[model samples]
Target: MNPAAPVHAIVLAGGRATRMGGVDKPAVVVGGRRMLDTALDAVNDCARIVVVGPRRSDLDSTVLQTQETPPGAGPVAGVAAGLAVLDAEPGDRVILLASDLPFAEPTMVEALAAAVQDADTVFAVDESGRLQFLLSAWRIGALTDRVRSLGSTVNQPMKALVPETFDTVLFRGVTDCDTPEDVERARGRAAASPVSIAEARRAILEVVPPLPPRSATLGTSLGATLAERLLAAEALPRIAVSAMDGYAVAGNGPWVLRDDIRYAGSSDELELADGEAARIATGAHLPSGATAVVRDEFAVVTNTSDGPQLSRSQDAPVRDDARRRGEDWHEGYRLAVEGTAVTPALVSAAASAEVTTAGVRGPVRAHVAVTGDEIRREGPLRRGQTRDALGPVLPQFLSWCGVRTVADTHLRDTSDSFDELFREVRQPDLIVIVGATGGGAADQLRAALDRAKARIVVGRVQCRPGGSQVTALLPDGRVVLGLPGNPYAAVATLLITVPSIVAALTGRTPAPRQLARIANASEVSGDATRILPAVPQPDGTWRVDPGIRTAHLAGIIDREALALVPAGAADGDLAELVPLPR
Candidate 1:
């Protein structure tokens, strides 16, 4: 790799922010420059700047429209278009970033580029240890084939490409701005700063702390505190019943005759005298004196003047169906241990072993709040209104992890209203508010949260389309998350942020979402993680494309998964897509 090779920076600026009244988000201003410029300035050290979007004019850099091959579908096509323009040098590195991020810093970009020196790809890790796929570095040669595979829609997440041939770069510079209000807040911060870009960079870096390592354990009961070893089972006496009709006999004991026995039902008890025999059905307890009970089917009943005689039938030998006392369970056996998931089979086995109520960890609780005035209700929409779309979607997303909404409230997009709502719903272990955390006139979520004496855990993340995300902790010890109202941004914040908090609270390890790769190749600029909505194909692959219009519910209706285009994706670049959990 050449230490001085010219590096190209690609900024993705083509998101449609419908919540801000269907405005072009990149054109929104923060401080003195547009959000696009803020992102470009942060990565100025790169050799060239390429803007990837629908309109070339939206970006100040050399604009590249999505590729003509896949036509105008969505970000995956746009990325393929961008990567098609890059020079195919072996060591050339491309840094991809999202334009909506107002707080991204140049230092973070440099760090990501440096991390992917020998690997095919590298991405940023946020303060909470979540991977920022949009802000990353890519090795051009490694992703060339994958980029060509994307179709009109992207079904997989961008991170899926990493497992194919990539690595990761963790930094704090990839913040995204998804809603109109987020754009305004970035502008406000810029206006308040002597050097707005520097201030934003500082804000992003302040939240950078490595996440705690995840542990691998077995024998831990499902939901129980994890441990390396298995738990020991208690001593108990148990028996197994014959599943079929057959004779019971001790391996070394004499078999009793059929006629000398008194018939007993399946559950009947009997007392036997020495040298006496009894006929027992399946599940019937063996008499005290009888070593084994032979089946009547195999024993011959001979009628004579004396009492009927009994003996083994000449047809065949009776197979043993008898269970010895304490055969199923020994004095002691370890049936289950710690760190093991409590499966149905395990539960049943424990019951048979006389064990009940295995220790389990408790579930984590989450509270979500959606704030905004323009949000529509689910019922019929009047002349100029619609239903509150986000209200329904956000809860569905959280339900994937089995986390229920313990408390929720909707407030008007006003400071006082927001403050009041926060006061009411902050009782949950964790709280999430959707919309108005940005900078617009109606963006009162951040201010209202401030008034509630909430400590900003992570005020802003460095990523595209979802940068306005704010995480705070109330004085009463409840965690809160503020998500932008743009449907896509809100979904992204929940996907990236909420899951971690839920995992921490519930003591259950978060499982990885299923992953696939975009069939087409695309390129993007800058150093921010980019998330795109996509649909899955019959072949188990995903296609990257645009989402449904904000007003057209049909556009999002068939959305199969979320695709991630890393910061490293170049024009004609291949990225990973993670499917939403079913």
Candidate 2:
């Protein structure tokens, strides 16, 4: 095989699985992933992947997609259609695959490539001695010739394109699902279980579509993710400038010093001929004929017969302290890629690159509503009234997570309080409702969501102290993030879950996981995944307060993070750490 040649993939996914009742077979979920995703994973190393089927909304927008000449004609016709849109050299390789192969491995393609060196095509032989024609690799040139030789590709059996003398390699994981029983058997390989915290987060990320992006000045887009690549509008330091407070010298120093002093922001035109030097301040535009900048410390100035002259110190090391044009970035150079968070540093970098406005999703504007008739945030608290501890500090916690809290209000416990909040002229992208998530007489967030025709992405999480949390999408595109009423539970759930919602709303890349070995994981672990207050040790491990109360945030006062200790965790197992605001 030519190593320099590129390999392209054609995933045949348009087949009408009549035996499976015409369901989208490629989209069938088994082992917590779509079968089409499995197929795509197998071809991840290819130069490009072309899926021959109807455009799938869930598929990555970058993937090339097309359909057979007549939809669902056959795999042979699907191959011809895929080749129509495929961009590849005749010498490059092509890996044709069926989307229903849940167990297919990329190694199968490698093995086929090795065997196809001696033949035009190589097929994989399943354990049952049946050849999987679709799970094969082909020489692009030979495959195209065979395809062109055929009179008509429509309704043709895949076997018709097979060469008389093709090679075969026996490999496991070549299983294909043709019936419901087959899919069941594939799913049966993995144990059935309730969704874990990790699973819940993944579901929210996959299900929540990103909000539309809008152009905003970088000053107003802090914490928002870049919807498009941030390219430099113009070069950084658009002109050559001095990097130090010194003289802009031409040729070797010991030159005649000019009277003009170029200060920063001095746009007055200046120039220096050979054997000349001009006093220049740091960041000042260099004179027309300047070669380098000699710092004050590196140069000695002497009054000459005609004028002052500049010369380098005998002990000074050689250095050119001149910042050239485009030193930081050139015009049109990409400063940040799509999905990058607009951090403070990013904002400054964009400004340096002369990018003033960018298309961004959000720094996620959220309105926080504390629900309960008895809750009070005032000078005095009456009998049966509790001080609102969560409402005031929720914004600080949200700010730490990059969400901007726009409004904070108390929601009355009446039936229409939440209904009215939903129907009001909504401006914030998210409504964080603290309380009313559980099933109770006063808990009406769920009912209000139903009345508003909202889609509940997460009805309840499976973690302790925060199991009643909910995440829903309103019809008008606002997200309703319901939190538990207890201060600590609400905080813990907010810290762990809000990041995902923010990313879903703003298209921000989810922050990388922060994991630390839990020194006392076994002590805090419970029947379900436990979100416990944890303190860090000097040894870089974490310890949890297993007996801490979740009713108030006092237990976490001294803790630096919340350790997500899985059920049945051992003493030193690694646990994900959700950092507390310092």
RMSD of each: 18.1, 10.6
Model-by-model lDDT, in order?
Answer: 0.58, 0.87
Which of the numbered candidates is closest to the native, going by highest TM-score? 2
lDDT of 2 at 353: 83
State in Å the error of residue 503, model 1.
1.0
TM-score per candidate, in order? 0.50, 0.71
Give each model's clash number: 91, 0
Question: Where does model 2 exceed 4 Å of error?
Answer: 1-25, 28-194, 303-307
Please estimate how well model 1 matches the true structure, expressed as its whole-model Cα lDDT: 0.58
What's the lDDT for residue 294 in model 1? Answer: 62
lDDT of 2 by residue, 1-582 (tens): 686677889999998999999999998866556789889998988888999998888788868999998998999999999898996778888899999998887888778777777778889998888999999989899898899899799999999998988888998656889999898777544212235677557656765778898999988888789999999999978999999999999998689999999999997998899999999999999999999999989999999798898999999988999999999879999999999999889998888887889999898999999999889998799888999988999999999999999999999999999889998839999899999998999999888988988766667666898888887778878888999999999999999989998888888778899999999988878888899888888998888887777667889888889989999999999999999998
